[model samples]
Target chain A: MVNKENKFNDIVTDNGKRIRRICSYYSPNHEDRKDMYQDILVNIWKSLDSFRGDASINTWIYRIAVNTSLGFTGKAFKQMQMIVDVDTENLSLLFDEGTKEKLEQEAQLNQLQIELNQMSVIDKSLMSLMLEGLSMREIADVIGITEPNVKVKIHRIKEQLKSKLSGGKHE
Target chain B: MNNSKISQDTNGMGSFIDKLKREDNNLQKIFKILKITYIVLLIIYIPIFYFEIEKGGLFQVVKVVFIALGFSTFLFVFAYAQKKIKKISYAEPTLILLKKTEKRYRPFHLLDLASIPPILFLAIGLGLSEKTFLATKEFFSSDLNLSTYLVEARQFLFSGEHWFKMLAKTVNEFPMIIVFMVTGMLIFIFVISFVAGYLLWVSKYKPIRDNALELIKEIEN
Candidate 1:
């Protein structure tokens, strides 16, 4: 028999970063994030026995992560309802800051994080998945919405983000 | 190995899940204890009821029916709550999952109201059956004519008797004291139930409902 603990270890080892990143979206506090991580671990263990593999494991993990993060009620919930700061310092690498200095790039990224934090819960969830470089199909599968619905929502969200950030001119 | 990172952070994952398993077992044990308590009550009740049935009359049968109704109603509620808790699947799509979670955490369940009548009936049946508290027998007794009750109440309350005098008279009247005592107890119980229910809704269910609704709105839109 495959040891359940070893299997759980494998799952967490593979998905820990993703789960941690998702937890960070909902809880900026490190202790709370750990708590969230532990919660997701428990939930995954709860869900593991039922996995029929109808969807890919990645999609399943995403579902749990998003569901757990949204449903999460902890000391962190009221303490940190929004994404305060993520590893956005590295997110600066994703954008060509062009001639902007490092601090300016960091500032711009902070502005982006602020805008992200302002998005509705669902919208922020979608954005988080999108930022993870999941395709529309993958995002839809993970979110349990139609691919077309995901497309439309992502379109609206991107438009809202662009409008908010550019017009927001978060100096 | 990348596994080392997870081990560093979640090294106790196995032990933690074990603790959770123990806690879960404890919860299940509590549920079992509750089920056993109910069964034991029914078992004890069977003999008491059988003895009461030997002294059998209409009130005895009425007591049996009302007690059965109370127990049956509670059983249905218990089964339903357990089934609903079991049915919640975290793996469902976000929309469906939120809807289920929303239902689960609704601050008030209309189905809960179904038990009130049964409970009231059970209380009445018990009061009449327990064979003490003469006031309960009097209340449930056949001599409780409506006009007589109204006339007596009117004479007692609105008669030219002063309020303090009325209270003194009430205290002097043993039956009235018992009636007021029963009524006061019931009212106190009702008030306590209402406050406890309110606290449970506010502290536990309302926040979950609000969170679910927020997500549901976002998703549905």
Candidate 2:
């Protein structure tokens, strides 16, 4: 029992760091990142008891973490109801000589987070794992989709991201 | 509205979930402490009651009765504490603030009324046992017929005792019996009130409660 608990804790520890890093990519503040991280941890712990070993432990943990993060993001959206509609012309007016580079980077990251949030939970999971450098087959196995489906998802995601990035550039 | 907007929404979600996990952990700790204290008190008290009964003989029933009431009151207070803990677990602190803002009050929801009947039966059983003991005392003291003993017992209780000395003893002893009845009645009424309040909250005010729960989940999330 102790050994099993230790193993579980190790999994959570590794997965938690990944979750935090993934969450920080989107969340701006300490509190929001912490909340997202805890949400991932709690979901992982809750789902642990039902984790059959058919999929690798790594795959199972990542699946729960991604799904939980997506839910957290959705709930936050509903709670805040904050939507930024940046005007393309106004963007130039908002930037200053001193903060121009910093503002651009922050804006780009925010735009990317928003685009990811709008995607389906599964799509978000697929894209996030792909971002983590997992093979398409591994991503498919983790998300319970076929490799061909993973390929299709990645293709669509790339298109979506490109359009979003282009829209951000226009703004 | 679009992808970038959705991303900003999810960014805030992480913080809400962390707060909820911490709160749940704290509540679970409090629950464990209460359960441990209850078990410890029960172990210490049960033996003391048995020792008192053995030393004082059965006629020292007054002491036994007082001890029983004390133990029971202690138990009732514990039960009340447990009920409170259960409610606090379900009742999110954030939702209470929301209710105050909405000017809507939450009625107390009670547990099952079936818990009352067993306690009521126990109280009645104790009263009957008291009657039997009184009849035995009369049989020894006055050689009164069993039926006569029954009449005297009823009269002494309902009509008040005629003999000054007997009246004092009856007054002293019968109050314990009355205590049992009063507590039993209070328990019965409380149980009934609990059922009524819960039903009213569930049927008439479900949406309000649901909204409260949602607000709580939102705050926690």
The TM-scores of chain A alone, one per candidate, are 0.79, 0.64
lDDT of each residue in A34-69, candidate 2, tens digit only:
776666665554455456577676666666665555
Native contacts retained by candidate 1: 0.37
lDDT, candidate 1, at A67: 81
List the candidates' TM-scores in order: 0.74, 0.38
lDDT of 2 by residue, B1-221 (tens): 33233223345344433343465567667777877876787688668657766776554455556546655655675577566544421111223434442334366423343345445544443444455556545446664466754554455444433344344566455333343334344655776887998788787666555554554443333
Candidate 2 segments exceeding 4 Å error: A1-9, A12-17, A21-26, A42-55, A66-171, B1-35, B48-221
Looking at model 1, residue B108 earns an lDDT score of: 65
Residues B66-150 of candidate 1: C-alpha lDDT, one tens digit per residue: 8888888887877777766655556667787888878877766777786687678778768763433456566766466777655
**Model 1 iRMS:** 3.3
